[model samples]
Target: MAEGFLRHLAGDRFDVASAGTDPVGLNPGAVEAMKEVGVDIARQESKKVDRFLGQRFDYVITVCDRAKEACPTFPWAQSLLHWSFDDPAAAEGRAEERRAVFRRVRDEIAQRIRRFMARERKANKDPAQ
Candidate 1:
């Protein structure tokens, strides 16, 4: 969801990618939640963190606590950021209940992405930042 929002909101400003320590494919609830906001993440694949090992990036961000702990060091990355969010995939209950969890997390992720984009824009405008 973060990737989708960043791509939609940031446009060509940032090259965004997301992976997890333990991927369990894309969640249907997540896809539905993104679709609700017109952000189609249906084609986004869940991938293992190993796929991006050794790659250099301006920022490497982890969106969950487990990921923050399990993520390997990306010394090549200029910055490492951790935004702890609940693992909505782990949400348990009936279909609508699970969808609700996805929606909540999706909204949270969108809000965080907006803040991140704003910070980046501000930093770009200020030389001393």
Candidate 2:
């Protein structure tokens, strides 16, 4: 969700990727949630962090507590950030309720990316930001 939302907003300036220490495949609810916002992540593969072990990222972010622990220090990254969010997949209830969790998490991810991009934009404008 974070990668898709960030790419949707600022792909021109950022190369975003989403991976996990132990991926469990893309959630259908997540795909639908992103689609609600016009971001198609159906083709985005669920990746393992090992695939990106040595790759350089301007910013390395972990979006959940488990991910934060599983994510290694990106020695090549300029910075790292952790954003904790509940796993919508764990939401237990009716189908619609589970999808609601997905939508909520998706919106939260988008909002966080917006703020992060805004800060980046300001920092670019005024080196001290």
Candidate 3:
């Protein structure tokens, strides 16, 4: 859902990319939840965080606790934010329940991303003195 939120704010100020420590493929439930909100992440593939090590990033944000624990140090990152989220893939119970979990996570990610973008825009407009 981070990707979805980024796409929603595309062509704006933020350049966003999401990668995982293990680099597993995109979750189907995640795709469906995003589709419900008019964001198509069906073609977005999982990426390894190592792929971005050579480049510079203003910030590196991890969305899961496990990823935060295992996050690699990005030499050029100005900041690293840990917004730990529940592992929707690990949700148990019926299929619907699992989907519900994914939807909740997706919504939470979207909301957080929106807030982050707003804060970032404000900061860029007025850097600390």
Candidate 4:
């Protein structure tokens, strides 16, 4: 979802990537939630963090509780932010209930992206970052 937001909100500014320590494939519920918001992530595939280990990123954002810990330390990253969003895929009970959780997480992620974008814009405006 962060990738979706980054691409939609500020793709021109930063390249975005999303990965996990243990990938369980893209959740259909998450795809559905993002679809409602007009972000199509169906083509995005699940990938392990190892694929990005050697690469450098300016910022690394982890959305899950375990990922913050499982993610490797990026000495090259200027910043690392962790957000403990409940795993929508882990949501139990009915299908509607699961989708609700996904939507909640997706919305929360969108809000965070907006906040980050605002901060980045402010920093870019300043002579000193």
Higher lDDT: candidate 1 or 2? 1
Tens-place lDDT per residue, model 4, 21-128, is: 988888888888999999999889789888888687889899888788778888778888887888888899898988899999999999989998888879789443
lDDT by residue for model 2 over 5-34, one digit each (tens)? 888888668777889898989988899999
Prediction-by-prediction clash tally: 0, 0, 0, 0
What lDDT does candidate 2 reach at residue 42? 89
Where model 1 places Cα greater than 4 Å from the true spot, the runs are 126-129
Clashing pairs in 1: none
TM-score of model number 2: 0.93
lDDT of 3 by residue, 1-129 (tens): 786678776545567688989987988888898899889889887999888887898888888989988988887888988897899999999999999999999888988988887787687784531
Which is better, 3 or 4, measured by TM-score?
Answer: 4
RMSD of each: 2.6, 2.5, 3.1, 2.5
Rank the candidate models, highest lDDT first: 1, 2, 4, 3
TM-score of each: 0.93, 0.93, 0.90, 0.92
**Tens digits of per-residue lDDT for model 1, 27-102:** 8888899999999999988999999999999999999999999999999999999998898888999989998999
All candidates' lDDT scores? Answer: 0.89, 0.87, 0.84, 0.85
lDDT, residue 29, model 4: 89
Clashing pairs in 2: none
RMSD from true fold, candidate 3? 3.1
Report how far residue 85 has shifted in candidate 1, in Å: 0.7
